[model samples]
Target: AQTVTQSQPEMSVQEAETVTLSCTYDTSESDYYLFWYKQPPSRQMILVIRQEAYKQQNATENRFSVNFQKAAKSFSLKISDSQLGDAAMYFCAYSKDSNYQLIWGAGTKLIIKP
Candidate 1:
């Protein structure tokens, strides 16, 4: 079984600043997948970035990037140049493979301190 945990319940950052949200996971498999999803007030799940367990380089997508530590089982999301629109609940997810279900973290509510 795999589980993800987000230690930060809520985080705030000024517009244009950067913020890093912490996440850790427990998995037995050597190869798996990690993902960061953003859910705004609309409640729609949006994939911010994804990292393959075998990949050594961190995954990045524009303002979103992940610091994936395979040995530590930690995958943290870094949001750069944060915007007001970025305010939402971010979730850390893990999956063994395509056929498996995604294990989700509790969630981190992001607030923009405009």
Candidate 2:
């Protein structure tokens, strides 16, 4: 069984600063994918970053990057130049090769301080 764990329940960062959200997962499968999804007040799950288990390089998108430690089974999201729009509930998820069923974390609420 695979499980995602988010130790932080809530996090706050000043606008224009940076913040990192922690995530860890347990899985026996060798081939899988890790993802960080952000759900805003609108309740839409938006993909922040994705990391393939087979890839050694971390994944990044604009100001968002992931520190994917395959050996430690940890995938943390780092938001650079945080903005108010970045404030949301972040969820760490895992999916086996082509499996649509995502094992999700409890979620971390990110608050952007003005």
Candidate 3:
């Protein structure tokens, strides 16, 4: 069985700073994909970033990036220049061999302090 664990239930960051959210997973499969999804007040799950287990380079999208440590099974999200709009519930998910069925984390609520 695969499971994603998010140790932090909630996090806060001041506007214009950076925040990193932690995630860890357990899986027997050697190949898999990791993702971070953001759900705002509207309840829409938005894909923040993704990382392939085989890729040595961490995935990045603009101010959003992931520190993917495959050996340690750690995938953390770093949000740069945090803004009010960045406040949301972030979930860490895992998919094996492109199954598309995601094993999800409990989710972390990010609050932006002005």
Per-residue lDDT of 35-88 in model 2, one digit per residue for the tens? 999999999999888899999999999999999998899999999999999999
lDDT of 3 at 85: 98
**Candidate 2: worst-modelled 10 consecutive residues by lDDT:** 95-104
User: Which ten contiguous residues of candidate 3 have the minimum total lDDT?
Assistant: 94-103
Give the TM-scores of the predictions, in the order they appear.
0.97, 0.96, 0.97
> Of the pair 2 and 3, which is ahead by lDDT?
3
Model 3 Cα lDDT, one tens digit per residue, 2-114:
99999999999999999999999999888999999999999989999988898899999999999998889999999999999999999999999786699999999999999
Query: Tens digit of lDDT per residue, candidate 1, span 11-101?
Result: 9999999999999999899999999999999999899999999999999999999999999999999999999999999999999987789
Please rank every candidate by lDDT, starting with the best: 3, 1, 2
Q: Against the correct fold, how does model 1 do in TM-score? A: 0.97
Pairs with steric clashes in candidate 1: none
